[model samples]
Target: MTALPDDLARALDDALDRVPASRLAPVVERLIGDYRGGVATVSSRQGPILRTDDDAAAYAAYRMPATYAAVHDGLSRAAEVVGRLAPRTLLDVGGGTGAAVWAASRLWPSLRAATVLEGSEPVIALGRRLATGADDAAVRAARWERTQLGAATTLPEADLITVSYVLGELPEPVRETLVDEAAARASTVAVFEPGTPAGYRRILAVRERLIAAGMGVAAPCPHDGACPITGDDWCHFAARVDRTSRHRSLKGGTLSHEDEKFAYVVATRAPGQHADNRVLRHPLQRKGLVTLRLCTGDGAIADRPVPRSRREHYRAARDTGWGDAWPPP
Candidate 1:
C-alpha cells in the first residue's frame, strides 16, 4: 500500500543520516548475511527485489526502517509514561544502535548511566559511536560496552528494562529467559510488537507471562481480561524522526509510505509504578469525540483530541524527530 506518512517522509530524509548508509552498509550485510544466503530473489511492492542470494537478507534489513521505528517508539513511550517513577538505571536489551536508549535518556536526564546491551559487532559498533562521548588520547584505547546476552548470565538489576521489537527475532528458549529475567530484575518492563494480528498475539503472550509473574498490566489495556481490543482497532502511535540527520535516499513528496503501528504493554513489579493511561490518551485519543481504555477490567474511557476526521486522525500519529524535521534544512 502507501509507504509512510508525510511527516515521517520528511523525518526519514534527515534521521537516516545519523546512521549513515556508509555506516549501515557493513552492519546490514552482517545482520542479514545468513538469512539471505543462497536465495535467488525476494518479492515486495518495491519491484523484483533482485539479489544474488547473499544480498537478500541485507536488502530486507535495509527496507525495515518503518517497522523498526514503530516498535521503538512504543517502548520509548513506555519509558516516558512512567518517567514520574524516577528510575535510576535504564537498561536497553537488543538496543540496536541505541535508538530506544537515546529516546529514554532524553526523557530522563536523571539516569545515572544508560546501558545498551546488544549482540552484533557492526551494529553495536555503530551504537557505541552515538552513546559514547568524545574520544581522545587515553580514550584512544577505550571501547564501548556491547555485550552478548545469554540465558545463564544475569543483567545488572535496573529500574527499567526494555526489549523492543526484538521478541520476534529471538529463539524461543532465549526469549523465555529474557522475559523471566526482566520479571525478576527490573522494576518496570515494556515490550512491543507491530499492530498486525500476529504481533498482537505475541504481545498478549508476553502480557500473560509477565502478569502471571506479578507485574501489573499497563497498555493495550486487558479488555475484560482479554487484550488487543476486540475490534479491528489497534493500539498505535506515530513517531516523528528528523529527516536529514537520518539520511533519506529519495522522497515522493508526502510520506504516504511511512506508517508505523504497534501494540505495547507496560508492566511493573513495584506498586504505584504503573502509568495512568490519561497522560498518553490525551496525546493520541480524540477529545470529546473519542474515548480511552486502559485495557483493564474497568476499560476506562475519557475525552481527548481526535483529528478532524478519520483520515486526519490517522495522519496525526507522530512520535520521534530525527534531529531536524522538515525540508532537509
Candidate 2:
C-alpha cells in the first residue's frame, strides 16, 4: 500500500530500518517542537508558519514527516514535468526548503540554472546550503535569496518558471504579478496546487490571463467551463513521488498517504505550443461503456473534475468551445 517511487521507498526503508520507527517518531516530535520554538525554521518564503513557539504551521500544514524524503520526491516529480515543458533555465519563485530546486537540479542535461526567489530567513539559510552543493557539479550555479516576489527582483529570460504550492498564501495582486513575470520571460509557466476549489480557482485565473496573452493550455485543460466537482466539494488527482535521498526519514517505515494529490496548470507561452503531448483519440473501450460528466447550474461546464455523467462532459466541452477539437478527443 505504499505510493513512494523507487528512490523514496528505499530511503524511507533505510531510515526506518536504522532508527526504530517507534523511537524516530519521538525524535521527530522533539525536532518539530524545536522547529516551532525558533531553533529551526522550515524556510518558507512566506512568514513563519511556525514561529519561536513549539508549534510550526509549516509542518502542521504538511502533516510534518519525521524526515523530508517525501517532500523531495514531490519536488523531483514536479521538476521533471516542468523541465520537459521548458527545459533550460528555470526560475523557482517562492522556493522554500530548496527541495524543488534540488529536484530541478537532477534533470540531467535538461536543467541549466535554477534561481530561487525566497523571502524568509530560515528558508534562505537552508536554500544556501542546497544551492551551494548544487553549484559544485551543476552545469549552472544555483542561487538563493531573501527577496519578495513583488520586489524589483527581475529574472533573466528562462525556459520554465515554476510556482508550486506557494501562491495561495499571497494576495491576489501578488499572484497576478507572478503570472506576469512568468509570462514575461519563460516560454511556459506551471502553477501547481493542492486539489482544492481554491487551487482550481487560482489555476483558472492563471490560465485565463496566460491564454489572453496568446498563451495556450499545456496540462489539465479542464475543458469544462465550470467545476466538475459536485456538492460544493473540490477536485484532486494523485502523483507519485520518487525520492532521491531524504525519502525514508520523512515517509517513515511505511507510506500512509499516497502520492501528493494536487492540481497543476502547465500553460505554454506561445499559442501553438499546445499542440504537444497528444495522441490520436479513439472510441471508448468496453463496448457499452458509459461515461458521465458534470454540469453547472447554468448548464455550463465545470472545471472541477468529479465523477459524473457524459452530461457533465457535454456541459464542460460546450462551454469551453472544446468541440472535439484538434489535437485529440
- lDDT of each candidate versus the true structure: 0.50, 0.49
Cα lDDT tens digits, model 1, 245-321, are 22243321244344445666778765543333322232333343333223333454433333446554334333312
Which ranges of candidate 2 are over 4 A from the true structure? 1-47, 50-86, 105-108, 131-136, 151-155, 222-235, 241-257, 270-329
After superposition, the stretches of candidate 1 with alpha carbons farther than 4 Å from their true spots are 1-83, 133-146, 150-153, 220-224, 231-235, 250-257, 273-329
- For residues 1-329, write the lDDT of model 2, one tens digit per residue: 11323332333243335444454455456644654453432233345443321122233213322113333333333333333553667777877645455544554456777777776765555445434433324412667766766634466677777776667667677788788778878887767666666666777788777776666565544232333445665444444443323334443535434455565666675433322221112212333242223232332343333123556543443333111222222
Worst 10 residues of 2 by lDDT: 275-284
Tell me the deviation in Å of residue 156 in model 1.
2.6
lDDT of 2: 0.49
* TM per candidate: 0.61, 0.59
Q: After superposition, how far is residue 280 of candidate 1 from its true place, in Å?
A: 11
